[model samples]
Target: MDLPVGHIVTVLEEMGIFEDDSEPPFEHWLVGRLEGLAPGIRSEAERWTRVLRDGGPRSLPRREGTVWLSLNQVCLALLEWSNRYDHLREVTRDDVLAHVKTLHGHQRRDQPVALRSLFTWAKRQGVIFRNLTSRIKVGQNEYAVLQPLLPEQVERSVAAALTPAARLVLAAVRAARVAQIAVLVLDDVDLGNRRLIIAGRARPLDDLTLKLLADRLPTGDAGGRAPRTSTTPTRPAVPATTGSARRCKDRTPPLERLRVDRQLEETLTHGPDPLHLAEVFGLDEKTAMRYADSARALLEQDAESGFSRDTRQGGNE
Candidate 1:
C-alpha cells in the first residue's frame, strides 16, 4: 500500500511528533519506511529513485521526466516484492529477471536497463551480496504475431467498421503493419497494376481493396501533405515535458480488428524474412524479423494442428 507523504506529514504535525536526542522524526518520515525493505537496502533504493527523479539515469542522462518515473516505478515494485526481507541478497537474480519480463510484457528497453542499474548500485553499496544485474539480459522487443484468420472473421470485422481502416488492415496483412499503411501516399497506390510501391517494394492491392482505400484516403495524404508520423511499433520513449505523461489515443478504426489477419498474410505470403519484413513494414531488420519469426511460429503451429486433425480423421474413418 502506498502511504501518501502529505497524509503522513499532516498526522505527525497534528499529533506533535517531534525529534528527540535519540529519535529523528523528519529524517525517518522523509524516507519511505516499511517492513518489506531492509534498512540499508531501503535507503539505497529510495535515494536512487530520488536521484533519478531529479535528473536521469547516471549512465545515460538526457532529460529528467523521460526515464526517471518508469525506472522508479520498477524500483518501487522491486522493493514491494521483496516483502519482509531485510536485504537484497534474499532477492535472487531470477526474481529480478521475472519482474523485468512483466513490465509491459517485456517489450521495452530502458526500464530493464534501469532496473539492472539499480541492482548494480545496490551491490556497490554493499546492500546486496552480488551484482545480480550481470546475469540479467534484456532482449529486443517483438511486435504482434500474424495469425491466419478464418473467412468469417475477415467479413465480420470489415462489416463492423465505420472507417476504411479495417480494409486497410486486411490489405496490410499482405503488405505491412498499420504505420506502413498510414504512410501510404496517393502516388504510391498503383491501381492500374493493382499494387502499391512501398519502400520501393511492389505489394499487390486487389481491386476491391484499392477502391476501399480510394474512398477513405485522407485529402492531406492525397494532396502530398505526407501522412502523420507514428512511433515505431514498439514501446516508445516517455515524453520529457510535463503534461499528462500519457496521451489519449483515439481509436483508428477496423485496424484493431484487422491486425491478426494482416500479420498472417505477411507470414503466409512473405514468409519470415526480416529484411523483407523491414522493407514492407518500415521497421529495422531486427524488429521486422521478430514479427516474421512470430508469424512463422504461428504458421508452424497451424500446420501441426492440421496434420494432427487429418491423422485423427483418417483413423476414425
Candidate 2:
C-alpha cells in the first residue's frame, strides 16, 4: 500500500478540498486554482506506481508542464472511478471511454495520451487483457485564429517592461524561434551594423526591430558588446518563516502567472518545421502548429493587401 488513506484524507479535509463530489478533478484543479497536490499524486506512491516504476521496457515517457500535468488529472480520475466501480480491477473500456469523452477536446488528446500509457502498463500486469485505449481518437492540431488587430496594435498590448513584443519581433524578423530569441544578450545585437548574430550566424535586422530591441534591452557594455549572463531563478520567492507567509502573499499577487494574450507571439512565431517553434518556446506541438499557421495567415493577408494596393494605384493611373 503506497497510500496511507487517513493522512491523505486529513490533509485534503484541512484544505477544504472538494466539498462537492459532483465536479471532475480537472475542472476543480483549474477552478479552485489548486497550488498543491496530494503527496501520492506528486510522488511515485500511487497504486499505479508498481508498473510505472518497475515496468522497465514498457515505462511511460516523461514530459514536462501541461503534458506531465496530465498525470494528476489521471490519478484523480482513477481514484474516483475505482470508488464508483468498487475497485480499479473492475474498470472497463466503457468507463474510460465515457470519462475521456467528458474532457474538453484538447485535453481529450493530451490526457488520453497519459491514460493510454498507464492502461498499457496495467494490461502487461494482467489488470486488463487488451489495450482498450486503442480506439480513442483526438482532434488534430488547430491554428490560432488571427485577431482583428494589426502588428503594431498587438505589440502595444504587451507591457513595455516585459518586452514580449520585442521577443516576438526579433524571432519573426530573424527567421529564428523563441528559444534563440530568449537566449539573446546585448552581445547578440549589433545595432551599429544592423545585424543580430545567433549561434555564430549573422542575421540582418531591419531598423525598426533593431530600434525596438535597443530601447528595451539592458546593455552590459559601454560599447554595447558585453554579454548578459544573469538569469531569473525558476522558483518563486519562498517565505522564510510562518510569519512571512502572509507577507509573501500580500507582496506578490496570489494568481500571478502573467497569462498575457499570445496571439501576437503566435502570429510572429515562424519556422519551416511545426515542432521548431515548440522546441524553441518550450510549448506543446499543438501550440507550435497553431503559431505557424497564424504566421502563414498573417503573411498571406499582407501579400493580398499589398497586391490590392498595387491594383488601386494602377487603376488611378
> What shift in Å separates residue 186 of candidate 2 from its native position after superposition?
4.9
Task: Assess the local accuracy of residue 247 in candidate 1 as a C-alpha lDDT between 0 and 100.
Answer: 16
In candidate 2, position 23 carries an lDDT of: 71
Could you tell me the lDDT of residue 68 within candidate 1? Answer: 42
- After superposing candidate 1, which stretches have Cα over 4 Å from the reference? 1-73, 76-114, 120-130, 136-146, 163-209, 217-254, 284-287, 294-317
TM-score of each: 0.45, 0.49
Model 1 scores a C-alpha lDDT of 0.53
Question: In order, what lDDT does every prediction score?
Answer: 0.53, 0.48
Stretches of model 2 off by over 4 angstroms after superposition: 1-68, 124-127, 147-209, 215-224, 227-288, 299-317
Tell me, by TM-score, which candidate is best.
2
